[model samples]
Each structure stands twice: as C-alpha cells, then as structure tokens.
Target: MKDTEKISLLSRLVAMNTVNRNEIEPAKYLKQLFDDAGIKCEVLPVGEDRANLIAEIDSGSPILAISGHFDVVAADAKEWATDPFTLTEKDGQLFGRGANDMKSGLAALTIAMLELKAQQVPINGTIRLMVTFGEEVGELGAKMLYDAGYMQGVNALMIAEPSGYRICYGQAGTIDIDLESIGKNAHSSMPALGSNAVDHLIRVLYTIKAKVMARAAGLHNAVLNTDTLFNIDVFNGGEQVNTIPNHALAKINLRTIPEVSNAEILQIFHDVIDADAAKYGSQINMHVEMDLNPVVGDPQSKMLQLIQRVAKPYLLNAKFSASDQQQNQIVTKMLGRELPAGTIPALGAPGGTDARRLLVDQPLGFDYTVFGPGNFTSHQPNEYVSKSMYLDFIKMYEELFPAYFNEA
Candidate 1:
C-alpha cells in the first residue's frame, strides 16, 4: 500500500467516535476494505453499535494472528489543540485521540494485510487479524472473542499496542476492586453516637498501605523486573457535613506480576477487611470489578527472536530511506531517547493489552508480544503518534507477515 492510502485509511478510522462503544460502523468500514480486496472478512456484533471484525488470508495450521482494538478512550476536544477526531498532521506528528493509543497500529496492520492480499503472496499458513473494541475500558471485547473460541488456534499472536517499536515480552496483569464501608448515620454533635464508615475505611486503607503494599513491593519478577503496583485510584464518602458519614467507597487498581496470582491478591484484601472488621466492627464489602492475569512470553522464543531481528535495523538506523524522511523523523522524538547503537528492544510493558484476555486460559501456551508504535502519550490530551513510526511499522508488518509464514 502507498503512504497516501495508509494516511487516508487511518484518517477515516480516527474520524469515527468509538470512545466507548459504537464499533459496528468502523467494523463495517473495514469489512468493505477487505471485501474490495476479495479477502474473507466477517463483522460479528457483540452489542448494539459494537462489533468485532475478523479477516483472514487463508485457513490452516501454523496460524499467525495479529490483534488490535479500534475503540479508544474518551477525549475532550476542548482539551486538545487540534480536533481530537480529525487526524491533523503538524510538526511531523499525527494528532488524534486514538492515533497514539492504537488506531495507527491497527491501521498499519490492516495495510499489511491488504498489501499481502493484493500482492497475492503465497502462504502455507493462515494470517488473521482480530479487530476488537472496548480494550481501553477493559478487555471486554477480547473476553467475548476468547469465550467464543476465537483463540483456539495453532500458533503465535502479536498485540499491536502502543510500545514505540519496543518488543514487550511480558505485561503487568490488573484487577480492579470496589470496596464499600457501611456504618450507621448520626448527628455530628454526638461524636460517638455513630460508627463512622469513613473512619473505618480510613483505617482499612492505612493498614493496606502500611502492611500489604509494603510486602507486595518486595515481591518482584526477574523477567518483568518490576514489583506489583498498588493504587487506591478513587475514594468517596460523606454526603453532608453535619451528619456523620454512614458509607464510604474506594476503587482499587492493582498491577500484578507473575510472582503474585490474582487469587492470592484477592485473599489479601479479604484478610485485610476481615482483620479490620474483627477489631473495629466495620462492615466493608469488596466487589471485584475486573480481573486479568499477567502475560509473560518466553524471552528466548522464536517469536521474540523474529521480532527482535526484524526491529534491529530500525532501532539502529532510526530512519528509513531518503524518500521516507518525512515519515521517519518522529521515531526519535516519540521515544524521547536515542536507541543505543546496537541495542535490541526490552521485555516489559507498563500497561495491559488484549493479550491479557487471549492468554488468560493458557497463559504460557502461546507466543505473544506487545510490539508496535506510539508511546506514553496515549490517552492524554493532544494524544499523537509519530507519522514516521506509523509508516515504518506498516512496512515492518508487511515484511514480518511474509517472513513468518515463509512466503517471501
């Protein structure tokens, strides 16, 4: 595919407001692209205005799958310098809501698929693209796809999350919990008349910070080289100032490592709540809102080597041909650092991706990596992607698909 075609497709994708849902329209648009290419594609609706698209080059063993999500996090246009939905190219960067987070990666993958089909590249195995929605909120779309047996496959998978050309062999898992403390309401004039739920919750939070979190900090994974991250993201209590608050709520998010399992993490919260209740007669309820296990790929796996090898020249050169200079300048700027002369990409990702859902059942069975363009700017105001990096990744995927399937 030409660079013009790539930019046009990405612009069209970003123009659609798929903030939370309403993925059906984009799915249809992509389906039309595949149909025009005479490729086999299907749009599977998961909910009203929400859907998943699956396109294939062939059907057989040794299947290689690429996964990406089109739905992006909500963006307030007022906060951005450019219209968040319109793909604006300025200063060699593409500014848009989903541009950095994923639409660029998704578009690049689509372009690779289309290029391969158009070229009539010979493939002994299947190359599939699983387009999903609702990845930012949770891996809801991926879960639905996995539960429906979309992952019952023969081989490797790559999640095109924003990683700035790095190869992420492992990513931290996450669990979101909602904890509510319930107590009796009474007048503030009588200090001891009401058992203040807010007070009880404060104690619980303190205990967790002092005991549980400190212990989690010590538990680290050698591969990921990171310890578990614990955060009390949201807290709410007290409707009025005069009355003692009868109820309080806290939303907790934990980025777990392989060293700690989800079951064990949940038990820690349970133990904390139980111990606090036993001592202070506090009524605290815990509800698990979301749970996804960590994904760790073999560092020495063929898939990792393949990606590392393919990405080496790009990391070293940091620039494409003279004809592609305009699209190549953003690579260094986006990463905020120069790639050490011969350094290969590293193995850890701070954020989670659809790999969490894909590998939940057989966490260690598949070869998976989070490899793509873009960076930490994702989900922030003025979210943008390096136009050069976006163009480079498209060529990389085009090369990788043929090499992985031995069609070259």
Candidate 2:
C-alpha cells in the first residue's frame, strides 16, 4: 500500500473502539490485515473477548519482536471536538482515541512488514509482530505472554509506544497501596462515645505523606510525590449522618523508584498504620493493589545505535533532546499531577508501561528499546498522530531492520 493508503488504514484502526476493556473486534481486524499480507497470525485469548495477535514473518533463525498494545484508555465524547472513535484529520493531525497512544505505531510496524515483503528483504532472522491487549490496565497481556513462553526465542525486542521518535532506555517502577481504619460506632448525639475512623485515617495518610516527602528530599535520581500517594478514591462507613462511622477506607497509590522494593514500602505503611491504630484505638488493614519494578535497557546497544543513525536524517536541523521529557510531561498532565521527588528521575515515566515487565521478567540476552511516532497525547480525548510522522516511522523501521538483523 502507498503511504496515503497506510494512513487511511490507520484511520480505520483508530475509528475502532478497542478501549482496554473492549478489544475483540480490533484483534480480529488486525488478524485479517496480517492474513491479507500473507503473514502467519495467531490469536491468543486473554479473557472472554480480549485477545493478543502474534504474526510471524518467518519461523526459523533468531527472532526480532516488534510489539504494541491494541487496547486504549477510555475517552469522553464531550471533551473532544470530533468523535473519539472516528479518525478526523485537521491541520496535519489525525485525531481520535488511540490515534497516538498506539494504533498509529502498530500501523507503522504493519506497513514496514508489508514493505519488506514487497521488496523481499533477505532477513536472516524471524520478525514477529505482537499486538497485545490490556496494556492500559496492568501489563496483563504481556505478563500472560511471558508466562506462556510466547516471547521465548527473540534476539531483541522493540515496544512501539509513543516516544516522539527517540529511543527510551529506562522507566520507573509503580506501587498501589490501600489503607483503612476502623472504630466503634455510636450515635451522633453522643459525640465522644465513639471513635472517629475518618480522623484517624487522615492522620495516618498525613504520616505517609511526610515519610514519602522525607524520602523524596534526599534523592537525586529518585522522586517522591506524596500528593498522589493517598487518593481517597473509594470510602465506606457510617450507616447514616446521625451515626458515628465505625469504619473508613482510603486507597493510596505509590510510584516507587528502582531503589525501593514494594515489600519494603508496604512494611513502612504497615508500621505507620500499626502505630496509629495503637494510639487512636482503631483497627488497621492494608493491601497492595499493584506493584511493578523499574526497567532499563542498555544505553549502548546495537539497536539504540541503529535507531539513532536512522533518526538522525529525519531529525534534520530540529533540536534533538531526550524524547522522555515530553513523554513525562504528557503523562503527568494526563494524570493531573506532578511527579514526586525521589520517585525515580523522570528518566521519562510520568506513567508506567509493559517495558518494565519486559526488562524485569523476561530473560536476558535481548536488547529492548521503545520508539514510536506522536507526542504524549496518549489517553486523552482527540489523541492523534500526523500522517508525515507515521510515514517517517515506517521508513525508520525499514532502515533499522537490516542494520540489526542482517549478518556480516
């Protein structure tokens, strides 16, 4: 297909609502695309309707994996000027939900494969195109792939997450925590008769904030943002306004640096809760919602060098800087907050991704880097990618394939 045709194909993909929870149709569409291109594809089921697409160009020799997520975050129609699920082109930008976060990247990879087939590039290794679902939730699909040994024989991997054309080498870890406090109930008329669980919970939250702040203060590469540490997302207690609440719960999420383990942080929270419970006559319960370790790729890998060489000409006279800066800013804005000090140097993660899972859980020997088109418009209404940018990405991949996979 011509570059324009490729853009149209991408627009059709963006129009499809593959939002994390609902991705079956998109998976089927992708399988059809691969089949038409004469690529062997497999649909790995994750849940009832959620599937992962793995298409292989060849089965023998060392394998090179190119991956992206099919799922996108939910979007609100009123917030966008155009339909969130329908691609709209305006001022050189293609707008729609999942336009930039990933569908565009996936299109680039798919087009590159088509171009290779048309030219019959003599590749010494197999090239696998992996489209996974549930990246927005937790790296569920990636975890399943790893556990199922779907990623076993790759020599190298590239995650086409939007990096604004720069290679991403590292990302911070994440931890989600929940803390609750319980007290005896009493009638509102008897003010002092019953303990105030809400008040106790606040005190504990404040303590955690302080500790996180203290940790943030001493770090150079790490950050600790306490403001987001305790998000009172859901709360339950008190039968009525007249009754003193017997219980209260607060859900806190912490994004940690590589230096801290989730277990260590959980212990700290437990200690604080225990102390508060002992002094305030309340019961404390804590649970961990999610925990992910930090991930970093080799700075001087062949893949990194190849990417730099391929991107140099496209960058032209444009000032080049680490792509992570914009990525971090975009993520922070999406979350409506700033990262905390000591958290992890914004090596470029205002949010986490499957990259961490690939780096930490996958076995060694393969180099991994994240490179893709578009800026940080991921997860927002009217998210988009420019046609020129998408085309450039395909060309970049074409140049890279030979450098990394062709033997001497």
Question: What's the CA RMSD of model 2 in angstroms?
Answer: 5.7
lDDT of 2 by residue, 270-322 (tens): 88888877787668788787777656556566777678777877765333235
Model 1 stretches astray by more than 4 angstroms: 320-342
For every candidate in turn, the CA RMSD to the true structure comes to: 3.8, 5.7
User: What lDDT does candidate 1 reach at residue 236?
Assistant: 99
Clashing pairs in 1: 327-388
- Each prediction's number of clashing residue pairs: 1, 11
lDDT of 1 by residue, 6-39 (tens): 9999999999999988899889999999999999
- Strongest candidate by TM-score: 1
- In model 2, state the lDDT of residue 174: 75
